[model samples]
Target: MRIDRTALTDLAQGAAFLGSGGGGDPYYSLLLGQAELARVESFELVPLDSLGDDALVVPCGWIGAPTVSVEKLPSGLEALAGLKRLERELGRPIDAVLPIEIGGGNGLAPLVSAARLGVPVVDADGMGRAFPESQMAIFNIRGLSACPSVLTAACGALTVIETDDNLTHERIARGLSVALGGIAHMVEYPLTGREAKDHAIGGSVSAAIAIGAAVRRAREGGDDPFAALYAALRDTSLYPYAGELFDGKIVDLERETQGGFSVGRVVIEGFGGSGRMELVFQNENLIARRDGDVVAMVPDLITVMDRETADSITTERLKYGQRVKIVGAAAPAMLREARALALVGPGAFGFTDAYRPIEALNGWDQG
Candidate 1:
């Protein structure tokens, strides 16, 4: 499928929702994608099954605090430079590129690289949604090695990491992001077509596009965008359940750029002095509490959006006095499995509460 400007816009909208208040904001990414679309007609997306078994697929994305990414723009050569270096390192041409995560800016990030490399983007990603750390990717959760990964910054600096330990790879990459001014493009977990087909989260690209389209149409038709968003999410097999978690205004926010990540929390008070919702984050939203009760947790999708417009407000974008609606969606089923939970569940982030389905906790299942 070819991704044009319309699809790209919808993609940004949809990706922000899927990002679960992480993956950085999609606004800048949309601008970057639009700029590229003006030069090229469209971006080509190829299915995983279309590639040869031996085809080399590189997962590409921007790595850094979303807060920093908004201020420090890319030099437009980061992705291409990284991919070119990886090609040199492997002594082989890459057949395609894919998003490391199909949420926020990362979802559209690989397009420029693919265009420069003259390669197509695989219709899949390592993480179905954005996670703060590289080790949280499904590629790592599935036991894939992240070593031999390449990191590139806007300043023309490049580093190739070769580690048997994925966690250490994340540590090294995080440090590099901090060193490089809090943002860099990465091409990691180079995969064979076979491995991509078997382990990578598939169809997330198209799903994002579809979800965006649904919301756009609802807005144009003067329908309820939040309802449209929930309906659209429920229609997809990837996100099984979706609903509103809270409707309120931001009362307070505590955020800081720490260790290369935007870490903090936001407090939202209900409109009629009803209650409050608090969300904690580290690049991406980790958990949400309503009136001091755990209503949603990680590995499940949680996003805060404009109450009237349905535009997702990422962690870095939350501001006091903004009327917002917190939306929650189920993560891809694969990420909810026992083994997957060990890596992404609330416990993984130091929360004592065990993983629980968003639907179950919010009465969405009964609804």
Candidate 2:
């Protein structure tokens, strides 16, 4: 599928829904993507089965603290800069662009890159859900290297990791991010179209646009936007679990920006029960365990929005007295396999037992 400006707009909206509460702001990312679209004449979506096994594919993305990105705007050439450095390091022409992770911000980063560099972006990504660590991609599970990573910063800091170890590459990149002012621009994960199809979260870009459009339509039709989102993701066996809309003041929120990531939690008290609910976040909302039992966790979409406006809120922007509605959606099944479970499952994030599907947790009263 060829993506045009309209598609990109829809994609940004859908990405916001999938972001699940912590994938940074989609607004800025969309503006950047739109700027790129004006320069590039077109974009092509290459199928996974359409390329040679050894064809060179490079994934480009921005990594750093979202809180800082708001104050520190990019040079507007970061992804292009990072991709060029990687091409120089590899001594090979980049065959295509790929998104390393699926999130509101990262999800659309490559579109900007593809438009700027005059390259097509593969219709797949490394993780269906956003994760903080560099090595959390399925590429690692498939025995791929994270280096020679071509790391770039907004101010023209560039370096290459020649190490074959993903963990070592992660450590190097993390340090570089801190040194470069709490954020690093990166272009890595060089793979082929065939490998991309075999491992990536397929059709995600298309899915994003479809879901976004559905939500828009639902609102126009006087239907629930959440229900529209649920239907769009029906293929994934994921649905939104509707709970009480916490239209109360945010009593307490503790946050710390560390290691180029935002980590924290928010506590909201119900209007009547003195019933308190806590949401834990690390770049993204990982778990929304009410009182005691775990209500939702990673690999599932846990999102917060305004009770009246339905505007999505980022974890970094969450305040101490925000009336928000908590909505949970299922992630794609690609991230639900035993292998993915090991990578992003509850235990992977240090939770005790494997997480049950969100629908199961909802049981009979899924509303």
**Candidate topping TM-score:** 1
- In lDDT terms, how accurate is model 2? 0.74
lDDT of 1: 0.92
| Regions of candidate 1 where Cα sits further than 4 Å from its true position | none
lDDT of 1 by residue, 1-367 (tens): 9999999898899999889888888887888889988889999999989988899999989999999999998898899889999999999999999999998989988887898899999989888899999999999999999879999998999999999999999999999999999999999999999889999999899889989999999999999999999999989889999999999999999999999999999999999998999999998999999999999999999999999999999998989899999999999998998989999999999999999999999888895
The list of candidate 2 runs beyond 4 A from truth reads 235-249, 271-274, 364-367
- What TM-score does each of the candidates earn? 0.99, 0.91
Q: What Cα-based lDDT does every candidate model obtain?
A: 0.92, 0.74
Q: Count of backbone clashes for each model?
A: 0, 2
RMSD of each: 0.8, 2.6
